[model samples]
Target: DQQVKQNSPSLSVQEGRISILNCDYTNSMFDYFLWYKKYPAEGPTFLISISSIKDKNEDGRFTVFLNKSAKHLSLHIVPSQPGDSAVYFCAASRGGGGSQGNLIFGKGTKLSVKP
Candidate 1:
């Protein structure tokens, strides 16, 4: 069974609108959560992250919120732009003693922002 899941395979939003991507995890051991954005033909790049210690983290136009009790997380991109169009992957790790890059990722949700 997949530890992390992105139920929505795709999302579409208009430019200047808010885009929200959702993710869920089955593993309670996950303490670190991250979101990655991938453009066509390019490797996924880290977008935002939130630690279990905090319920939310924000940076610029992007924000990540985590709900430990529900094992859920979400990524929000405000005023979405065409440049924001890409596949977003949700990832989680147990952290602490885990080796580097030891993360479980979701299948990814392709986001298309239209002007």
Candidate 2:
């Protein structure tokens, strides 16, 4: 079973518009949530994170909101640009303070921006 799921495989948006991506999880034990953005042939880079204790986290043009009760999360990008096009992955981990932070990731959502 997929612990994390990104139902939409792809999304397209115009430049300067807002882009939203959704994610869901099945595991209730997961305590830490993270979002990563990746380009082709390269590893994912950490974008933002939110602990189960909080509901929202933001960074500049990117914002992530989590609903622990619903086991769902979302990422929003404002004024989307062509450079923002990439695969976004939602990840979750059990927060026991482990080494390297092992994560279970969703299949990934590819975002396309038209300039």
Candidate 3:
């Protein structure tokens, strides 16, 4: 089973600035990594993901980066706004032989974008 770790419990960013959330994993065999954002009483929404074959992937204001050797990944949001405040979780899956066919999630980092 793949385990994801997000050491930072919370992050504060000023509006118009950048927010950087990090994630680390114990499994080197993880073939896929994803970032999800969650709001109160709402299900987590997929943000971005990166494959083992690629070091980075970007979509709109979000970007995901993967460092295979270190088994670490990060999500970056530029021009952070108040609406961007939410809990962000990092997930990983080994995806093939030993996978549980589900994503393993980190503890989640709460982001607060102050105006």
Highest TM-score among the candidates is held by which one? 1
Error of 1 at 55 (Å): 0.4
Using TM-score as the yardstick, the better of models 1 and 2 is 1
Q: Rate the local accuracy (lDDT) of all candidates.
A: 0.95, 0.94, 0.91
Using lDDT as the measure, which candidate wins? Answer: 1
Query: Each candidate's TM vs. the true structure?
Result: 0.95, 0.94, 0.94
lDDT of 2 by residue, 1-115 (tens): 8889999999999999999999999989888999999999999999999999999999999999999999999999998999999999999998666743679999999999999
Cα lDDT tens digits, model 1, 11-56, are: 9999999999999999998899999999999999999999999999
Cα lDDT, model 2, residue 78: 98
Q: Model 2 Cα displacement at 24 (Å)?
A: 0.1
Which stretches of model 3 miss by more than 4 angstroms?
97-99
lDDT by residue for model 3 (11-109), tens: 999999999999999977679899999999999998888999999998988988888889889999997999999999999887665446578999999
Error of 3 at 86 (Å): 0.3
Model 1 scores worst on lDDT over the 10 consecutive residues at 93-102
Model 2 alpha-carbon miss at residue 78, Å: 0.5
- Rank by lDDT, highest first: 1, 2, 3
